[model samples]
Every structure is written in C-alpha cells, then in structure tokens.
Target: MDTHLKMIDFDFEKLRPIGLTQVVVNSLGAMQDTTPPGSRLMRIVETQRDWFTLHDGDAEHRARIAQRLVNVLQMQDSTVTVGDWAVVTEGGADDLWIAALLAPVTQIARRANDGRRQSLASNVDTALLTMGLDDDFNPRRVERYIAMVRAGDVAPVVVLTKSDIARDAQERIAMLRERLPASVPIVAVNGMSEHARTELMPWLHQGQTLVLLGSSGAGKSTLTNTLTGAFTQDTGGVRRGDGRGMHTTTARSMHLCPQGACIIDTPGLRTWRPDADGAALAAAFDDIETLARQCQFRDCRHQGEPGCAVQQHIAPDRLMNFRKLMRDAERSEQTPLERIAIRKKWKSLHKAGAVRARDKRR
Candidate 1:
C-alpha cells in the first residue's frame, strides 16, 4: 500500500489523528477498547454529507460514514465535522467505512436552532477568536464568542485583524486587553503580514491543532493563507455600510500549516448561541464572576440586591451582558414546550401591563 505521508517538520504537534503512523490495527466493528489489529486512526479534515476526508498528516483519503457505526445520534445538522479522528479499515474509495469516532480531547461547537450541535472543530488546542478592527468589531459579539470558547474548554486567543485600515486599532486592542482576562492572550495584526504568523506562534507549536473561529469576512481565511504561506482558502470583503464580511469560506476544512500546525477554517456565523452552563458563563466573565462572589447573599442575582457586589464593581453594560447570557443559557435548557409557554407568559404579562397603564391614564 502506498501510504503517502510527508514528514513536513518535527516542530508542529501531530498529536491528533491518533494513528498518523498509519500502522493499520483492526478494531472490532464497534467502538471497543481493544483493536483487532487492522484499523487505522484517521483524522477527519473535512466532511461532505455522508462522506469524509481523512488526513493522518501524511496522506489524505476519502471514506463514507458507516451505516451501522452508531444508533442514530441526534446530529441532524451534520454527522461529522473537521478534526474528528475515526477508526477505519483500509480499502478503496467505495470499500471503506468509518467504523467509529475517536473521542476528541476538545470540541468547539455552537447550538443549532433545532437543538443540535454544529461542530466547528474537534481536538483543537487553541481557538483563534478572529475579529476585524473595522466595521466587524463589536465587543458584545466578542463576549458571546468568549462564552462559546469557554463552553468548549479550549484556550481562547483574541486576534484583531486588519489593523492597518481600522480606525484606532491600537485603542481597540487596549480596550479588549482590559475587557478580557489578563491571562487570555490578545494580539492585533495585519492579516497579510508575517507578523500575524509570528504573533500566534506560541499556540502553533508542534503537534498542536488550531481552529479559526470568527464571523464571515473577518479575515480568517486570509490569516490561514498567511500562516500556511499559500492561497489555500478563498477570501472576501465585508459590506461597506455594516462592516460585515461575505462568507468566503463556506465549509469547515482542516489544513496543515507550513509552520507545522493543523488549522481548521470555518464559515462565517451570523448567529452563535453556545450550549453553556453556569460554569462556562462564569469562566468567560471571569472579572464579573469574581465580583459576584463578594455579594452579601450567596444567591445574589445582582439585581438591585442591597449589597450586590457584581453590580457595584462591574460596568452596567458588561453586567447587563452577563445577565443576558445567563438568561439565554437558562432558556436554552428548557424544552420546546417550556420555551413556548414562557413566551406566552411574557406576552400575557405585557398585555396586562398595557391595560393597567391605559386605565391609569383614565
């Protein structure tokens, strides 16, 4: 078998795709502990419908998702995503089937409208939270993305692209540095420069996997091109009025960087609702969470409570955003019926309030 893998560089971590060596060990038909000594662990670089593109750092091949792989798990959005490792048996295009998915060390995903997970990538060591300094800049959206990264347990690094043309780009960077945790790393860069690659070198170590996460037209692909030293992905411009970019990269695909790291670039997302809990929210809002602990009551909701520490310490807008995320998280946990009921309840309350106000005028 011509197992085509090129040892690019030892500097980058090939920690993913468990069997990059392609030493075929057959695993049983199921996701069992023991291998049958003929299956290879292949990392999924890109998934197209029922088919997947597997890369073991050396060779790239295609395989189909086996019908009997698992009883229907609710991945209605898509079965497989970029950066998933799969147990497989070597065969020609039509003969191969992905036996099972290798559990990812970390997964960055978003909640679909139908209550399913839309995976951006799996086993990503660092999530590059890219945002444009131009029209695309929004602190509110960045806060949501921070929460999303926290939900996935991946290290979040802020990358402010297009510094050359952005208005007061340095000021924006300074503001973000203050807004986010002192521990979280932030860098402003020209997406087309070698500076962008150098700025992110710490996270691009050997065997490390990085994922590009930002809205469409946020310069994710351009950054990928700069890092990889090629035009591997397409690029697009943002709208002039709103500063929103066109969705240039329509699919989530993994690439091997010339710098010896694996990177996944995803499409622009207009709506990103994280499937998060209290801990995730707290982690994202670290400064505010710390202040919350100082409140007089253990169950301080931070709403005008006599000695509400979070309200007193944090800015009103930041606190409001945190509270909004809390409400969203709670709402997400509700079943469809419960959500409908809550909506109706709110409508009824608003109607009653309107009636009372009209009577008060009388």
Candidate 2:
C-alpha cells in the first residue's frame, strides 16, 4: 500500500464526530454562527507538553493551540490528548495554537497512581484487550480489563496472541467465554500472519479508532506491526524462563491501518487499578448480578444467608471475586475518615481470627 493512501485511512470527518458531543464546538460556537476560517478544527495525532501534532484529514502538521500565557481551561485541567478534537488558530508561516477543546463522546480513562483521572484517549470505538496465549494468559486480569473497558462504555474485543505456540488454546478460550460476557468477541491469532490481520479487519473498519491494552510481553506491539502493514512499533521477546516481557513500547502512539482505522498502541500497564462506580463493577459480573436481584435481602452480601440466590447458584470463587472487587471500589472512592474506620474494622476482625486459631491449637 502507498504511504499516502494509508494516511488517508485516518478519516477526520468520520472520526471527529465521535467523542464530539455537540454539532458546533470549540467554545467559539457561542460567539459565532459558524467556525471562522482562522479557527480550524483539527484532530490530535499526538500530544506533548508545549505543542501537539494534529491531523486535519488531508495532512499532518505540528501545531499548538495555547499562547504563552496560561489559560483558565488548562488551569482547570482540561488538557488535550491524542484523539482529542481542538480548534487551531492559523498564523503566518504555519504557526498554530489550540483555541478550544470540544467535549468527547467517549473517553478511556483510569485512576492514576496519585488517585487522579488519567484520560488515555477519546473517541475510540474499540478497546482491544491483547493477551499472549503463553505465560501472559490470565483469566482474572482479563476480567479486570473487561471491567475497565465496560466502565468507559467502549466495546471490548479479546485478542489472544501467539496462537502458533498456544497448546490447548481452545480450552483456555472456552474458559474465557464462560467467564466473560457473551457480547464480548474473542479472536485467537498468531501476530505475524496476514491471516490474523484479515481476521481483525472487521473491527478495523474505516473511521474507527482502536486502543491496544495489555501487560508487558503480551504481544501488543507485535500485533500492531501486523495491523499497520509495516514495522511501525518496536518489538521484543519475553524471557524464556518466566515468559515475562520487557517494556518495548514505552509511550502512547497512534498508527494508521491500511484498512482505514486508527490504532493506538499504549505502554504495558505495571499497575491497572481502575476507578469506577458501583454500576460499572456490576456490569463486568452480570451473571452474578442477575442472580443477586432474586435474593431475599436488598443488601444481600451473598454470604451463606437464607434465600441467598447468589450464594446458592454461583461458584464460591466467583462470588468471592465479586465481593473483593466491590471492596476495592469502595476503598478507592472512600474519604479519609471512612477509610480509617473500615481499616480499623478489618484489623479487629484479623485479631479475633488470630485468637481463634491459637485457641484451636491449644
């Protein structure tokens, strides 16, 4: 494929409307009937501290939206990210500054280690949860990712990589199917094959944006090269002993696919603690949730209580997993006082349990 033709796949008209809440945007909408000539709306290809590389459908160029002076929006932490729509001001000799940021229709975000929201990208249609079928294959971690993607309201597609070496892969796939919601699609493929690329084309349709997510050594970058039809991202092998992969892709970058979709490859997450509300967590465990509704108590903790439908029907391990997720969510959202009280309660229970164990021994 021609380089220029591949570039055309990054369709701005089709892509910009996604995550763009309103028809008219850029804050300038209030001031005028239509966007002015100098104020050009562009989609971000990449973002940096001072400037951004923007795409306007036809071409890509380096542009900046803010002047040297600090602005109220930036102060409010309304910063631009890759895939964000911004209105750029044209200046002499290609000088441009971002004028305003439009509201995103969908945003992929997570809680940063500091407890702040880290917005990964905007306007994405699909979140490809890439997992190596080798040692990187983990059912629990995949469930965690499903919760995160579902919370963002993005479609989650599971991609199991390294199928060439995947022994008894079908059995593992079956386990995932039983664990995940039936709505989520799963595909197993070797990352190096054209056949694998062919299988992925449905999700890589024109104007769609997909984000790659997985732990280090899960073959995300390897799959990215196949998607781009070029060696666009750097690739490396996992350790033979433990099958752990070193961080090959350290930063977030978007690549254009020949099939007309935008694929953003992200760094392997060392910590993937997601920040979500109660509804989001429940969505990931619909099987258990549906049964809980039939329980006798509204606040049915799913412990061995009378008329406990969840405890009666659900597996103990899955039920325990649900309870653990709810606990984690509470901890993440709790205030300082609430958290301290909860911590004290747990400590008291631990002390009682220790006393019981000693008594039994005696």
Candidate 3:
C-alpha cells in the first residue's frame, strides 16, 4: 500500500452538486488530503448487495468496494450505505473501486428485528417522514419515526400525504400538533400534485440532503418524484382493504432535485426500531425526559409512581408509548445472558400466579 497519494489535477467544485459541504469537507481532513492515487471523490447514490452507484457530480458510475476497504468495514461493524461519500479509483475498464469511505456528518439508522443495526442513509440534513392521512396514519408510529430520525441528530418533518382525500385532515393535523413537539413541523400535502414541492421547499435548500422515510403507502416515492420534478421513483397505490400502500421502491436511491438538493427515497419500513440507547431515546423524547426529572423518586419509571410528573402532564398514550420504547431500548442494550435472566424472572412470576390460582380452585 502506498503511504503517499499521487497528486492529480482535481476540481473541488464537482463535489458540491452531490452535497459536498464545508462540514463534510472538513471531516475529510487527512482522508481527502491523502486520497489514493488515480482516485476521485464521489457520493454514493444507490446501494445494492455488492455494488454501489456513485455520483461524481457530473455522472453516475457503478462501483464495488475494494477488498481492503471491505475488510476494514467488517472490522468496524459497518457498511457503505447510500448518501456516503467515498474516494474511488478507476480499477480497470468498466471497473470502479471504492478505496476509502469518508465519515458522514449524520447517519439515519434503525434496529432490525434480528437485532442488527441497519444503516439507512448517511450525511442527511433532514428526514421527511411521510405518513398517509388515511388508514396508514398512526401518531404512535409517527413518534417512533421521529425518535429514529432525531436519534441520529437529523431534523424530522412530518409529511402527511393523501390529505385531499382524508376528510378529517385538519382534525388529524391538530391532534398531531398537540401531541408532538412544537419544533417539529407537520405539513399536509397531496403527493400527486406539484404543490408538494412548494410546501416542502424550506427543507430542500441548495446542497441540502433529505431522506424520505415511512411505511409503504405513505407516499414517499410519490413525494420523491414530485420534489425531483421527475418520475424518478415508482409509486404504488394502497390496498383498499387496509390502505397499506404497495411497496413500489425496493431499494434506497438518491435523486438530484432541480433545486440543487438531493433526495434519497427509501423503501417503506414495515418495522422501525430505533437503533439507540436509553440516553439517545430520552433525548428524542425530551418532553417526557424533562418531566421525569421532576418525579419524586430519582428512578421513577413513570408507571403510576407517586409524584410522577410525567403521568401528570403527558398524555396517557404518549406516556405508555414512551415507556414501551424505553423498555425496548433497555432490552436491546442488555447482554444475551441478562436478557435470558429477565425472561426467567417474568416466567417465574407468571408460574407463581398460576400456582396460586390452582390452589384457590382446589
């Protein structure tokens, strides 16, 4: 391996169009300074099983991770996902190799059902969490999405799609506003129309990068198409029975908006568990955390505890959801042995209750 990079004429301007900012550039201090010889800086637009689609500000190129880079990522327990910036080399004719991955300023991730941390997108400035105003709408689910995005330090904007058809659109919006933090903006739009871009323009500034997140039938793909002013993503209709939208977008892909911003459209997440620890979860639900501090007991769980400030002020459903999320976070952080112990403890408690019931009947 060469410790020194062979210098070549390169223009920094090429990186800006693909979301290269001073923050990202500064993070690449020595990484960019020591770029591999014959390599070019590029942004990952599409990620697949073994290859990636990289944009060199002017065009998209298919590239594969170099064996050395793969080994390093494996050791670090990470992967190169969409929205990542990398230094790639022209390996050969029809071959592009990702030699090094620059760190992302922000990364949106979630915990899979199998307990693996799945990286959704990296270097995103905002998360446009799209949810339908129809049967697919669930304020609890909205809170979960907010937690997942905010956990990664990205701002979340709640986009309620299918607003034109939803008769109670205003009522739903008011309900959500009452439950959510005042800082989070909630916008209702008809995803099929061009007006969606105008309503969402505040977050789509030049050089900004945004990720559309929500479950299937949430109009993420439709919104992506509207924002980009092209049919870049496939949109599907929701089922008449459950109002669940068919999964039209299968993978994460970034599209360049005419406004000079980038939009990453992702598959609707059927299950989204926050990939965060207790502290991170608490930070996401600062309202609950703030009230918990005023509890009489230092370690109150907010479950009917005496002098529980959280229960006194927070809505019951919101409080319950927070408790459930906290429990999930704690369980995820537990070691295998610890989790087993918790199960055994609950099993014993259930067994004891059953024994008492049988004795009383006898």
Candidate 4:
C-alpha cells in the first residue's frame, strides 16, 4: 500500500498520525502472540461532579463518577474511587479512535452527609479553609473544616476574612495560631482589598485546586468574589443581632481564577461533621498530642490525672483547648462495628437495585 494511503487509513482509525504505523504493527504482533490484546485496548474513564453545582469539577465529581462506574460493574462505588485509575473496556469501536489520546484518569467521589465519604478533586495541591473574624469565627468550627480538608490528603491553609471588623486582629490570629498547628499558614485579610490577594498569591498557581470552607457570614463568598475580580456570586447581609451572614452560597462550585488556580466554593455549613479520626485530630492538635505523650498514663484524659504530662507542662487554657478538641473527635469517631453496619447497609441497597434491574429485564 502507498504511504499516503496508510496515513489516510490511520487518520480514519482516529489514532495519532505520528504513531499510526507502529500501533498497527504492534496490534498485529500482539494478536499473533499467545496472550490476548484486550488489556492494551481498554479505555480508562474520567468523570467529575461538584456538590455545590451540577457542573463538572466540583467535589461531587469524585462521588458521581465512582457511583456510575460501580453501577456499571455491579459493585460498590465507594470501594472503587476516582483516584485509583482503574482499567476499563471501551464500550464500542468509537472509543478506540480516541482511546490513545486519553490522559491519566482520576475519579472524585461526591460529598455525603450520612457518614464519612470521599470527595476528590483531581490535581488539587491545597485546600484553603476560610473564616471571617466577625460572628463567624469559631475555633471548634475551624478544627472541623481542617479535619475534612486533611481527610482528602490536601494541604490546609486557613484564611481569616474580614480582618477589618476585628478590634484586635493580631490577638485573634494569635489565638488561632495557638490552637492550630504551627505548620498551617494562617492569614487574616480584608477580602475586598488588594492586600488579601497579595497574601494569597503564592497558593494561586496554575493547576492547583483550593476549596473555601466556612460558616454563613464568614465572608467566603466575598473572598471568592474578590479573588475572581468579578461579582460572579451573590452576597447577603449578616444578621443584625449576630454578625453571622445568611446562607447565600447553596452549592459547591469550582471556578478558575485569573492567576490560573482552581477554587471550589461551598455553601456556609451550619454544622460540619468531620470525617477523620484520632490521627487527623492529633495532627490538627499536634501540641496537645506532644503534651499527652508526656502524661503519666498511656491514655491520659488530661483531667485531674496525677503526674499528667499534658497538665504538668501545658497551660490550663491550652489543656482545656486540647480536651475540648479530643471530646469533639471522640464524638465524631465511629466504632468499628458501626462502620461495618453502615457499609453493609449501603451494600444491601446496591444489591436491591441490581435485583430490581434483573427482574425488569426478565
């Protein structure tokens, strides 16, 4: 056959022109060998969903794609998330045309309220947890947000909004720094000003993903608007009695910043359920952990226990903070038996769906 004719054939097959001939030869070679070439011909799938919006690239993308694949395979989606980069078969010949051009796949699961679940955003390097200094500032709430972000293995950076509102901004910052791990960067900013943008510039690099989390009236939406340089989202006033803002942002949506970074903004959560356990809580409260290790008992509660290393070395205020956080974590943790039960419930629900489908076909 003429070289031009071969090139035309390759284009018709939708394979890249440069490697067309080599691919054909390789396929033939594989077919002639003892092993089947099925593995080489499969196409990986990628899907994304965000909770705040039906649009793609939100936190929900991870869950949606995972569920779809699991349903297709008649298995649990939670077990096979987007991050695993699984092998899948092409549905038809059309996939073969574009199969070679596919990029590495990463699936993200959706956020769920009933229990701890995975939410993935591909290529996310940082998770920015925002809180305003007005009525919305709460150390306990920040701890919860930290746990959620850390659960996803994303680096957490705390951004304090509405710094202008605080009478003593530095004092507030010091309190937060004392409570949170020193490694986590804490920045207080006036969201509407250029100063805030300057402080956040380093994390806004292209291709990096960040998620803004806070309660209503915390200035997360304001910060989003400020960072994007446009009134892309609506704003609402906070309550007069308390500085807490109304729940204006209803969904989690991802936007591309002018600087090339990607950000996911979620609605103000009135109640945040942390999806992590002892280790994540420990990391969030490293100082407490360090002190606890010095306590007399292997399992020191830090309450009235004699020779308690935590009590001995740490200040009363710091110990109180530690105890409060530990109690919060204890409430958040699910016993092994409870987890098993929850998993079984989900599996049963999936099984029932399968049975219904089989009956419909029959």
Q: In terms of lDDT, which candidate is strongest?
A: 3
User: lDDT of candidate 1 vs native?
Assistant: 0.76
**lDDT, candidate 4, residue 246?**
90
Best by TM-score: 3
lDDT of 1 by residue, 66-124 (tens): 67664443443345778877777655645667777755667887778777767778877
Candidate 3 stretches with Cα past 4 Å from truth are: 1-10, 32-35, 352-360
Colliding pairs, model 2: 19-104, 19-105, 64-97, 64-98, 65-97, 65-98
TM-score, one value per model: 0.86, 0.83, 0.93, 0.64
Please identify model 4 stretches exceeding 4 Å from their true place: 1-113, 116-123, 313-362
For model 2, residues 242-331, the per-residue Cα lDDT tens digits are 888899997677788888888888889877766788778779888888898999999988877799998887767667767777777777
Backbone clash total for model 3 is 1
Name model 1 segments beyond 4 Å from true.
1-37, 75-78, 90-94, 354-362
* lDDT tens per residue, model 4, 84-157: 22222224542321112112122223334665544444334576788877767787677666655665567889
